[model samples]
Target: MNGPNDWFQQNQDRYRREQYERQQAYLRQPQRPTGPPVRQRRAGRRGPSPLVVFVFSAVGLLVGEAVNWFKDVGPVFSSVCTVVAGLIPLLLDYWKSVAEEPAPGRGRAGAPSYDRGGTAAGRVLGVLVFIVVAGAAAYGISWGVGYVTGNETVRAERLVSPVAGRADSMTITVEGVGVTDHYTKVRISAVSRAPTAVDVGVGHDCQLVDDGGQTLQPSTVANDQTLLVPANGVTVRAVITFTGRPAPTATTLTLDFSWFLAHDFGFGAHSLQVHEIKLKADPA
Candidate 1:
């Protein structure tokens, strides 16, 4: 009963209405964001906190300074201080082991609680101990190597001995010369030709002079100080120590006994004298 044209117009009206309805429904719905997707940061293992590191470093520095201050006291004292410092953290860790009690109807009472703070502190202390031990071991090895090397070098070179020189009525004979990287030791015997006992003092007046004119003072004296030389030729042995190895060019050593003679022996400046000894591979 309907014509073809009418049928086509009805189909077109239905299609338009459906499209309008779909657009309206879409418009009523919430709008979706069109920006880039957000990303979440992944969790990872963390290192020691700044405060913990800072505290550990501060403690280490304090301990190091304390050890250095004890060096002048003696090596034994310094070593003891270092050992005690290393043990302090371990002792504190032991004390930090605290027992916690649970509530009356809860889990086992008097059980030990996990202390995160204490664990962290223990780890830091362990790291500090390792560093200290490694440093000490390295220092000892270096010292040993230096000592061995110094001895080898010293033994290869020849030095003059039995060299004698006189100042005023006192005569000094060089008995030995021992050289090393850490120190240089000279042994000498002194005797006086004076009719009476002569008082002689060894101090700054004693020095070692190199061929380059560089002079080094005695760091220590063994069995050597102010001495009384008997009237006869009775010899007194004195060992003089100078810190560190002397220059290879040290072919001569000059000793000034003027001050000691003037102060102790009542010798005038005009009567005072300086003694020079030649150091060589062969006797002169």
Candidate 2:
């Protein structure tokens, strides 16, 4: 048997020989000729530049604004004009590209050039056009709806009787204008000191009397009657009566309207009563 050192020496020598032989074979192979390095072409054909798309879109928006300002054109018309103007240039560019390209089944161009039609730039333009048109339509619809459903015209008036020794009366009238198919209801209330009292009566019977011998009738009150006022212009009235004992005092009356209709109005009789009277001794 060989000793351990002799066996190790022999194996090392065999491995070195195998490595040298592989290196020699690699070196003997023919060297590849290095010609001028081919440069990589940049992606995308030299079609209509992005700058063109941007310019066209900007021009379209400007034209739309001009039309809107000069002709008072509504959003629909403005948006239509904008889309048409913007697309016109893009369409022309697409057609030009199509015309320049070789017919189908022809030999491929260098490195499979991309078709300019429906390119990234064109898609971006299409999105912009769609947004403009949709936005304008929505704005116009909202404006029309608001104009139709808004509040109608309303007019209100208050009538107060002259001050008396212990009683006071007041009337309130509310009218509607441009209110179609609606009715009106009016409510009146009286309050006073010096033992004042209220008497609810028909449209013509409402009155106010004081202990100082002063009196007021319905004729003295304004908006005390109800009539079928037209929807175009109609008015409703309320009448209240107040009577009381003698005292040097002033009274305050309040009038309110509720549940008003155009053709037939309804509201409950309302009144406010107080027993304390504050009198203005002298009129300025």
Candidate 3:
């Protein structure tokens, strides 16, 4: 029979061989990755390109100008219009993207990639468009809110109309009568039927006489320009400003155009005047 030590040694060798084989088999098998699962990065939203920005800016400018052309409407209207236009590209892009269906067979666990405007060029173009649209929109909103509204530049209602008179061969139509913080303004259009242009002197004896016997002297005549009525049925517009505000309680006012008529050297009366210009019931 073999010795006990020899038998023990043989058993140990077999055990070691079995352990090595098991380790080799484990190494050959596919590995289950350790730590967190590697995730596919999502495509980011790109900004608008320079070309798109330029186009958008140009469009905004054109729209803004168009809106500004209406004199009755102020910059507020123009700015609002421009801003609204600027948002068009973005809105279209958003709607178009939203309207599209997701790529067929794509799932949440997959690459998660999809068409970005359909191609690489499209992506770039989309970026450009977005930039332009966004920039224009920002400018319009800022200008309207920051500059226009902050300044409170809305024009006040001032002009009163439908008052007229005639002296000699010159017909004077009062276009408007308006009051300001400092003075009252009277706008008139004078037409001369004479053969030559009539040189009307406006300063001397020109005044506004209120019902309360308050008289305000003429401060300036048509921004200090000479009042000349063109001949042969042509009309000349002039603005006459008086020094003081009329009395609030005064219901009726008179405008004396004596000096203007007298200096014309025509066939009309020198004392031409509008006896009564009815004031508004409520005064500001």
Candidate 4:
């Protein structure tokens, strides 16, 4: 009779043979398609393309220019409007991005990966648009601030100049101030005992001094070739102006000038002290 070990070995060999036969039978049978055809996942659509964003921004810029022309808007106003217009589209795109749905072929897990702009191109274009708008807005704000400040300073109350210095045979009087296309023009009168008409060189430019010890600059650019040639007379009157854009506005501005009676005569540099005359611009 066979012992326990002999019997165990025989049983194990029979089991192995059965398993191999079963596996071969399975392999020979027609195999069904694996795991129900991988469910085809669709990729959803993307957001606005980069080209679209770029085009929209360009159009916005053109529209802004047109509006400025039609409305005669200031530079600051035009720039501000353009910035606002350009940003509207960008804002919309951002909102869409924040609410983007899952794309086809991409699962719910991919939703979080949705970019602000649908496509890479779109995102890049959107960024460029934002940059342009931001720059324009900043520029507008700066320009507006400067303009308002400058106007206020030039429109303040005026202060009269100190009494004309006592000098030899010279009388400098502050006639008045008037508004011209260029600026608040200053008028001054001077009577000098000179033989011929004096060459009164207004000297390139002038400045307005206020009683509060504030110095005023001209509102307009200084005319490098500006000169005032007084008529031949004992009493000479001339029109002059100063740079006021940078100067403070006041009810009265002290007109300070070196009264050059007769630069043509032998008087040479021998002259009186600087003449200060208070000036007030005519009512607007």
TM-score of model number 4: 0.33
Question: Positional deviation of 267 in candidate 2, in angstroms?
Answer: 58
Supply the global lDDT for candidate 3: 0.61
RMSD of each: 14.9, 23.1, 10.7, 13.0
Write candidate 4's Cα lDDT for 14-90 as tens digits: 99999999999999997655442343323543445556655665565566555543443445554555566556666
Candidate numbers, best TM-score first, in rank order: 3, 1, 4, 2
lDDT of each: 0.54, 0.40, 0.61, 0.51
Q: In TM-score terms, which candidate is top? A: 3
Please identify which of the two predictions, 1 or 4, would achieve the higher lDDT against the true structure: 1
Structural similarity to truth (TM-score) of each candidate: 0.40, 0.27, 0.43, 0.33
The top-ranked prediction according to lDDT is: 3
Q: What digit string (tens of lDDT, one per residue) describes model 1 on residues 184-259? A: 6676778876666676656555566666777666664332455556766778886666555556656666655544
- Candidate 2 or 1, higher lDDT: 1
Candidate 1 lDDT at 213 equals: 73
- Provide the global lDDT of candidate 4 against the true structure: 0.51
- Model 1: weakest 10-residue lDDT segment is 149-158
Error of 1 at 245 (Å): 3.0
Please give the lDDT score at residue 132 for candidate 4.
71
Of 1 and 3, the candidate ahead on lDDT is 3
Q: Give the distance in Å from residue 258's predicted Cα in candidate 2 to where it truly belongs.
A: 41
